[model samples]
Target: DVKVTQSSRYLVKRTGEKVFLECVQDMDHENMFWYRQDPGLGLRLIYFSYDVKMKEKGDIPEGYSVSREKKERFSLILESASTNQTSMYLCASSLRDGGYTFGSGTRLTVV
Candidate 1:
């Protein structure tokens, strides 16, 4: 079975702290995406990678960065945590056929 696992289900961090969110897929998908879900903003894309060691800036990538060192692992990094950055982060993986499999998600709260 294919699975996308997130490192944390919930997290709390202080302002200005660096945060790391990790995601891993067992399906060997070629594409992975990072998105943050907010009340009004909906799901905004933060970063995406099509292959190992290759990343692309998504809709909102100002204070966030991503690293894809291996085919099954993708990491999201928050340069500096802010209150506004608190949200439910989702990770998704897909193949060339175009259907996505999402992780359980990590809810982060920045205070």
Candidate 2:
């Protein structure tokens, strides 16, 4: 079975702090993605990468960045945390077929 691992299930940060969320996928997937979900807004993509050292910006990436240093690992960074940025972050991996294997997700709270 395919598995995507997110390093944290919950996080609490103060405003103006930097936050990092990590994800790792075991399978040799060709694509990985990061998305943040809020109450009113559905899952909005933050970033995605198809190959190592190659990344594409997603729909809402205002204060976020991503790193895909290795094929199995993807990391999401919140440049400066804010109260409005608190949301559930999801990580997913997929192949050419477009079926996604997702992590449990990390819930971030900024106070």
TM-score leader: 1
Residue-wise lDDT of candidate 1 within 1-111, one digit each (tens)?
A: 789999999999999999999999999899999999999888999999999999999999999999999999999999999999989999999998999999999999999
The digit string of per-residue lDDT tens for model 2 on 1-111 reads 779999999999999999999999999998999998888988999999999979999999899888988999999999999999989999999998999999999999999
TM-score of each: 0.97, 0.96
In model 1, the runs with Cα more than 4 Å from the true position are none
Instruction: List the pairs of residues colliding in candidate 1.
Output: none
Least lDDT summed over 10 consecutive residues: which range in candidate 1?
36-45
- In model 2, the clashing pairs are none
On a 0 to 1 TM-score scale, where does candidate 2 land against the true structure?
A: 0.96
What's model 2's lDDT at 104?
99
* lDDT for model 1: 0.97
Residue 34, model 1, lDDT: 100
- Per-residue error for 67 in candidate 1, Å, reads 0.4
**Model 2 alpha-carbon miss at residue 33, Å:** 0.2
